[model samples]
Target: MSYSEAREMFADWGVDTEAALDKLAGIAISVHCWQGDDVRGFETRAGASGGGIQATGNHPGRARTPDELRADLEFAYGMIPGRHRLNLHAFYLDTDETPDRDEIELGHFTPWIDWATAQGIGLDFNPTFFAHPKADDNLTLSHPDQGIRDFWIEHGRRCREIADGMAAAQGGEVVNNIWVPDGSKDNPVDRMGARRRLEASLDAILSPDYPRERVLDAVESKLFGIGVEAMTVGSHEFYLGYAIRKGAALCLDMGHFHPTENVADKLSAVALSVPDILLHVSRPMRWDSDHVILLDDSIRAMAQEVIFAELTDRVRIGLDFFDATISRTAAWVIGVRNMQKALLEALLSPQAQLKQAEAALDFTTRMILTEEIKGLPHAAVWDEFCARQDRPTGLALQSRLEGYQASVASRG
Candidate 1:
């Protein structure tokens, strides 16, 4: 069906396609930098990735250097509609001087700030808490040793400062998300002690007050990892309470929760307590596998909740998946576009009509309309969006992907 005809059909349901498209254009999905290089940051002292993070394929065109990653990102951004931000890690710092995690400074990341400024995009940040000798035991921030905890605390502090620097350079606020790999594979005798140390370490790390407008602190939690199956110190309940007490943004990673749990339902519950939320939009096959996002029911439900709860302003959407089996750049484009598609579908929903029916106890109308809206010509509106954004749609998008992959086939 043509976009005009689809528009008329949506209008019959009291939905405005134009407004939906406009809103979709404004939402920026923070594309992760790790996907370009399969999470291998350019740290001189970089260690093997552990803590349940594994990017399993050896795609031919894995970005080898900072320049290559940035170039790949530029190419991916071209195909993706709307101006989005880049979520950077502290370990991705590009500089001549080799610096450890704790010693990293703003100068090391100045190139990224310049690049983001040039691209007319904003920056978000994360402290790399895994893949180091200190984290080899799967303990950081919550380590029993005071000195060890201090080391990770310093790293977290520096990351927040770097985030502040990024915000100052880009003239916007930067979300600095902290996720630790502190858990035990076997059942621990003293979970309380570890959690106490974690809380204290976090307090120390957040001691230095960065401007709220420039730096927003967020804490992420996990259920389990490959090694840490017995217990995860930074579980959902721990971070939820901490965020409420600290007035920090709570990060809800789609892949971090249990398989049976619905992240969409947690939005409203957490929204009531936390000041802001940072979402790590990822797809989990059976575990926290970090698969590339698809336009699936989970994504649609999450997007719908964001719209239904009127939590757009309070939520920051960011992608967090690294699938090395495919073209990395293609992975970025596909995942981001699917996120946009989900949001667009949510925007095009006849929410007012459905809500009105539910309020009036018209269960029959609500259920019928909800199911019927699924058959709407969403693809036609999506195609129109891509056309207006100068992005290829349908077969053209696939052709572009093939061409880009072939162009980068010689990467060694």
Candidate 2:
């Protein structure tokens, strides 16, 4: 199946394959830096992985330093088509002087800014609210102790500043996402108390108003984690209301919800209230395992909803998974490309025809057209996309990945 044939087929259904490719090329997925290093950021005072965050595999060639991680990211980006952004956590700061999470300054992240600028890419940020001694009790911003809550609040404030600096350096806005791991292993008597403290802490952190064009704040929620199974402080309902009231973006992590829950369904509901949305595209193996994403129904539905509802500008997509079992760079390339593929598939959908059928109350035509769309030559169009970007597809892509894996096997 050639691209021209595929294009003609799509055209017969009132879909423009060329326009779809152009849109796919413009959509940038914020590739997470943590994936390259198994979420082990370069903080000198880094503690043991805790707060429900754990990267399980001992894949050799794990990036041990900032430079190594950046090198791995560069290689992954080469295989992935289109310009994208880098999602950096606060702990990933690269500097000689040691800085605590609350004390981190933009100087510590200068190297990353410089790298992104040179690569002609954008930047995104996250405040690391886990794996610290203060978070040992599975609480940070919502901790019972006022002093402890204040400390985490300051960390959040500093992260926003760093995000502002990054946006200034890149000459664009940076999505500053906040996800706190504040929950009890068992049911707590003071859920309301903890939530109140969290609300106060967040208010304090967001007090200093940064320019919206430079720093786009987003709050993420989780259903449960390793130890916080009983109750997560930042649950979906909590953040949904908070985002609506605070005028911030609500982050919907694919792995943060129940396995049976369709994250795609929430897009339209939340879009009605929140100013914007930030998606953490991930795969959960019965839980928030942070496995690399595949081009499965979950991803396809997400892409289709964004396109079908005309919410492209309101939604910001980013990848969030860390699987150290495979070649780290390969994981990145595979996950990002899958996301691109899903978006392209959605873009090629005969949306006008589908909507017309639905509006006319013709369920049979809608169902038939949708079923037939699955048989379209999407793979041919995908191949053309990679070819246009000078990237390999099919067996060639696999061969390149194997060669890179072999090259990195020698890394200590």
Candidate 3:
């Protein structure tokens, strides 16, 4: 179905039109170096090669021209319904200057930042290759060169600096997200160099050098294999738990775990160990590489929905992916809406009902305390909860799930 048709169908289902609109509006896309229209064969090719192998475009070829790039950003902005901001990755900036430690140099590309500001959206400066494997094993912040170490440390600091400057420039708060694409294969243990580097980076981030309260440093973890190429923070719990011990919060990427890992249980366990949290929402697939699938894929979406259905207000979901097609933008927008629908269904699940039944275990204990409870005025919470439901609600929820299943089948 077309995007508008899907919206209309959801509206017709007694779904609050305004809420659906807002949720769709709340959805934003992250532009990887290759996903836009300006670059030829961009979706397939690795991005422009200048500063590094996976570095941002430079010198303005026909595909990487300034005007074309701007147009692509505008196109992405227009696709998001209203008042929503984009989560920008920093791989697009030309790193020709390689600025000094304390310098406030805005690399070769300022127009992208300017454009995002004008659109009433906040941009995440210093975006990293957190999802890609190359940045994990091949890169390091605390290398021998002072310039590189300074650049890495300065990059973390500058995200806060740019956020303040951007907020002043655009009149709003900007978000700072950080993830190290670093770890070893055989020895997943963080060496002195890795720990010191991560500590230095986090210290710069959490420093009072800028108003630290104004920014958020989301430390994203990854999940990979057992080989030398396998390096991610997801399995390296000690390192991640240590970071949280030293004042950094975890950004739990949904795609970054094995099928056996219960995401809800993981969150509960991690929350006990760590005080703060940020969530990265994506569809998980069973593979060694990152598979950027839509959120409605049942095997992936079910676990996420089950966890989030009972969520309080603390969880914040950020959509992360390297869009491989023009249709990916609209697909993601619809995918988020579909995931919410599944979450609503999951909330109404019989298993959850059973858990609620189990919560009444305390009711028996309270009843044993006093026989006067029977005579006194008391309300039946479970009866009232059951009273609020009917055959229609059940059918409606079942129909929605079946509809989602049918939709996935058709796509396949």
Better of 1 and 3 by TM-score: 1
TM-score between model 1 and native: 0.98
For all candidates in order, the CA lDDT equals 0.92, 0.91, 0.45
TM-score of each: 0.98, 0.98, 0.60
| Residue ranges of candidate 3 with Cα displaced over 4 Å | 1-34, 37-70, 76-82, 94-109, 129-137, 142-147, 185-193, 225-239, 272-276, 295-313, 323-355, 361-412
1-412 per-residue lDDT for model 1 (tens digits): 9999999999999999999999888888899999999887887544655666789898789888999999999989999988999999888999999887889899999999999999998999999998788888889899888888888999999999899989998899999999998899999999999899899999999988999999999999999888889999999999999999999999999999998899999999999889999999999998798999999999999999998899999999999999989999999999999999999999999999999999999999999999999999999999999889899977898998889888887895
lDDT for each residue of candidate 3 in 69-106, tens digit (9 for 90 to 100): 45544543443333445554444543455433334445
- Candidate 2 lDDT over 1-412, as tens digits, reads 9999989998998889999999999899999999888777886544544677889898878898999888888888899999999999998989998877788899999999999899988999999998788888888998888888888988999999999999898889999999998888988998998889889899998889999999999999999888888999889999999999999999999999999999999999999998899999999987788899999999999999998988899899999999888999999999999999999999999898899999999999999999999999999999999999899998999999889888888875
* Model 1 misplacement above 4 A: 46-49
- Candidate 2 — what's its lDDT? 0.91
Q: Candidate 3, 253: how far from true, in Å?
A: 1.4
Error of 3 at 111 (Å): 2.3
lDDT of 2 at 212: 92
- Model 1 scores a C-alpha lDDT of 0.92
lDDT of 3 at 31: 35
